[model samples]
Target: MTLRNIKSVQKTLGLLLTVFSSTMLTPIVIALIYQESTSLVFLASFLITGLFGLVLWLPAKKADTEIRLHEGFIIVASFWVVLALFGALPFFLLPELGLSVTNAVFESTSGLTTTGATILTGLDELPRSLLFYRQ
Candidate 1:
């Protein structure tokens, strides 16, 4: 891909990331409703994800190039990869879960893909925010 293509992908992925970060607020609401301490976890995840997205977006915001078919493919593939990584933030940040990096990414990817596979053992014991997040 050329630099323009890369910038286009970056711009798309950044906007997607910024939008996706808002989903974390659902869990924050869940946390507040259930009085769970996990609100901070989701809040932190939201800020980090949104900030990273904004950083990616600012540089290419003015790039008004049209996305070709090849660039579309690149964007789709890269979006999933970036989404999975950023989506893992909350799972990785939650200290009570004690999930490793691999497991956290796995869980995030599984959830995003709707695979329903989990390494976690205790569902009932987990906070509502976390449960809502996984769902």
Candidate 2:
């Protein structure tokens, strides 16, 4: 891919990331409603994800080039990868979970992809925000 294509992908990914970051708020609200301490965790996750997205977007916000077919594939793949990584933030941030990076990413990817798989054993004891996020 050319530099322009790369910039285009970056630009698209940035905007998508920014939008995706807002999703963290749902869990925050859930935490508050359930009176769970996980709200802070979600807040931190939101800031990190949003800031990363903004950093990615600000530089290439002006890219006006069209995305080719191959570029579309790249964008799709990158989108899922980015989502998985960012989606893992809250899971990884919760200290009580004691989840490794691999397990957290796996859970995030599985949740996002609706794979219905889990490494966690105790569902009833988990915070409601986390349970809501998993769904």
Candidate 3:
């Protein structure tokens, strides 16, 4: 992609980041409604990552709709990478969230890719809220 195309892609990324962040709020809201302690972890993560995602979306306001395949790839990959990076923040904050960086990324990718695997064990002891998260 040309420099112009790349610029456009960056803008779209910012917009997507904004959207991704908004959606993340739902889980946080759910946690709070039930007065679950997990809400604290979710709140911290929500504020940090949501603000970061807003930063990603800033350029999009002026971006053009036309974008090349190369630019599209860059945008999509960056979004997912940023997602996984920010996604890891929550796991670190809430270890009971039960995922390492590798495991989290693998599961995220696996779910998107539909790659079935077996590794997660002991669903019984996990709290109801966390179990809902697993689903």
RMSD of each: 0.9, 0.9, 2.8
Alpha-carbon deviation at 86 in model 1, angstroms: 0.7
Give the alpha carbon lDDT tens digit for every residue of 1-135 in model 1. Answer: 678888888898889999999999999999999899999999999999999999999999888669999989988999899999989999999999889989999999999999989999889999989999999
For model 3, the stretches where C-alpha displacement exceeds 4 angstroms are 97-99, 111-119
Q: Which ten residues in a row have the lowest lDDT in candidate 2?
A: 62-71
| Cα lDDT, all candidates | 0.93, 0.93, 0.63
The most accurate candidate by lDDT is 2
lDDT of 3 at 51: 73
Cand. 3 Cα-lDDT? 0.63
Model 1 reaches what TM-score against the true structure? 0.97
Ordered list by lDDT, greatest first: 2, 1, 3
lDDT of 3 by residue, 1-135 (tens): 565676687677766665655544656667777666776776677687767666655755566778768887887888878765655454456677567778766654544354665245775755454445434
Estimate, for each residue in 1-135, the C-alpha lDDT of model 2 and write its tens digit.
788899999999999999999998999999999899999999999999999999999999999659899989999999999999999999999999999989999999999999899998899999999999898
| Candidate 1: residue 110 Cα off by (Å) | 0.8
Lowest summed-lDDT stretch of 10 residues in model 3? Answer: 126-135
Query: How far is 14's C-alpha from truth in model 3 (Å)?
Result: 1.8
- Deviation of model 3 at 109, angstroms: 3.0
- Note the residue pairs that clash in candidate 1: none
